[model samples]
Target: MVTNEQRESAFLWTLDLLNEGVVALPLVSQDFSPEDWAFVFEGLPQDLRFSLWKALTEDKKSSILAAMRDDSREQLISLLSNQNLEDVALASSTEQLVEILDVLPKRVVNGLIKKLSPADTEELEDALNYSEEQLGRYVNHDVYSVNKSASVGEALAELKLEDLPVYTDSILVVDDSDHYLGQIDIKLLINSPKDTNVLQLAEFSDHVLAADMTLFDASESVKNCGRSMLPVLDKSGRLLGRFTIKDAIDVYQEYYEEQLSHMGRVSDEDLFAPVFTSARRRASWLGINLITAFAASFVIGIFEEVVVQVVALAVLMPIVASMGGITGSQTLTLTIRGLATGQLASSNLKALGNKEVRVAFLNGILWALVVSAITSVWFDNPWLSVIIAIALIVNMLIAALSGIFIPVLLDRMGIDPALAGSVILTTITDVVGFFVFLGSASLLLI
Candidate 1:
């Protein structure tokens, strides 16, 4: 068995070679796991990593890339040589190719497109024509579609001679004009008599994905269909390509990472991007937050007299705002998730809002009692306890309403809900929480 010492020694040796400008291709391919390779690549200087990456064969590079996560692959692509980039684009599936293209500059993309074969160029052009978030951008243009009149034997003969596309599970059935008719499962074709026509066994009435469908909607189609591949058709019912399960998964992962970055108020910057660049990207959101914070401070300033009169009010007011912020955040997260997954739509908004209000009402009653009891015992002031309890209930109700509406409004305004929703939600919760508590105290306690 390999000991920790042995692993460390090997890793260090690899690091030395990488630092010294040695490619170490054999050692990398034979000795290192994909994880090990990624770790080593991450440690090397950017220039040196590019040099080492250039030294590897195309197949080796593809294997390493396949092993890495999307973010890691993106970083590597950013630093790759033009020739290396061409190789990857040529070899990658349409989905992977689109991902690489998405991060590249227009000039570089145009340059790379010139290097590809006519067939690849056509496929890439089709993908490029669609919006970045559309399923058309990720469709596998290399799909095989047989005419409905073709026999199983003819289909088998075609598969034997043609270069099969990746993720091939079913042969798409099309009409004489190449319009999509249905699909024939490979297994069914293989088991059927050679003389049997494809139309006899075709699943003619099945779910077909529209090429113009958004990636989010396409993913939902993929989930509901539960098939290995779904035929993608254009507006005219022509079979353009296929959207494989693997492509659907890649779309899901890309959207997931994008949403996570949006939620964090970052633009999915490369992990090794310059410190200044990363800082600049975050500064905008931080600036917005600062303004919101000032707004909250201004509300507190309005009740300065009450705070001074009852020093305990200052100490306890933060608890009310903090609870509201946390409660609103929970609702915001759920609403954003529902929207992202296509589960929540405008039609369902009324029902969802009512459900959240009911939930908030129940939680408000229970938690208000708990806080009121604690405050009464701590300060030995029943009136102060009652005021805080009322404030808590009001804030909780407002928090729930704000959480649901903020994202919906942002989405309607064409702003990214995930990115802007939390900031607005926090502002609403803090301002309202402070206003209700301090305003109540000012009138009642004073």
Candidate 2:
């Protein structure tokens, strides 16, 4: 198996070539990792993407389809034969099928659902009703379950006749009405008396997931819970499906990628997506940033007269603004991390904010002294040094506070902090740093 580091290296190297329209199999091995193949799909054009998809085996096609972004998958799926489409629907897991269905034409989706087995058709329908952000979409419906009242021997006999699902550590025990009771491990079943009631030896757990639980909470629960698989129950505690470690990992990976998209404003469509469509998506954010940029510029314009009078202020303006932006950005990054990892919250928010402010204050004073000393010697103006030093300390202190609060405010409002926070922080730091530095110079230096 290829290691993760090696896979990333291959991805990076291959991506460079892909950007230039080369090695795209102008695609690759039918055995390529789903992620790598998805990358290949992203790098190739529409015609070649379909051609490559046709060449891969059915199983490979099923995986790559799930790995693809919704827009790209919809485009590629439009070109598939009805027989091939049914193959994909049948081959996919409940979660994968739900995602695939999300992007398909409604008529296509209806046709595909009709082709599924009755049981699968029901499972997929149940999953389709869930929000993509909920655990229902990601839960696996192929659970191995047994009745709690059944004898161990009876359960063992039935288990032998079925192919176990992946990561089947334990068989879920249920009541006659199909409500979840507990879990009976295979080892326990094998060693116990044949006549023993399955529930007599089962591990009753308080750690079951409700189908309506949010995906973020589900992922966190699956990660922290020691069990390799946890049962998904409906509101009535009936076993609906199971959330596995593998499922948690996939969710985490997807979430990490989503965060990356927010942080970098990267579009879901890969580098090879339609030019104008990609451009249009990017233009929206860049335009918001432009508005913020103008606000910072307006502050600089307010100090235009001060800058003209004190030539030294013009030279030293960027130094204070740059320092504030850098320091504020560092604080912003840490605050966002704490929020994502479930560390920082409103109750303890003040403590972290104070800690960062103190740290920034000390560092600010130190850097200010250093900059002032340089300004004194380089420009031979002591008052000019004093003005910049005051501006630096004030700007950095505010920068630290802004860093802590901005993300919190954005999060509370349901805006993605990673996407909009940086722009807003940069603008605040620039506007404040310039306003204070030049404002002081106007009153003192001139």
TM-score of every prediction relative to native: 0.57, 0.61
Taking the tens digit of each residue's C-alpha lDDT, what string does model 1 give over 35-82?
456544544434566877766666656546654555556667777666
Residue 233 lDDT, candidate 2, scale 0-100 = 88
- All models: lDDT? 0.69, 0.73
Instruction: Note the residue pairs that clash in candidate 2.
Output: 24-27
Task: Evaluate residue 225 in candidate 2 and report its C-alpha lDDT on the 0 to 100 scale.
Answer: 82
Q: Which sections of candidate 1 miss by over 4 Å?
A: 1-48, 60-78, 81-94, 161-167, 301-446
Q: What is the lDDT of residue 369 in candidate 2?
A: 85
Model 2 C-alpha lDDT per residue in residues 376-411, reported as the tens digit of each score: 886677998899899989998898899889999999
Local distance difference test, candidate 1: 0.69
Candidate 1, position 50, lDDT: 80
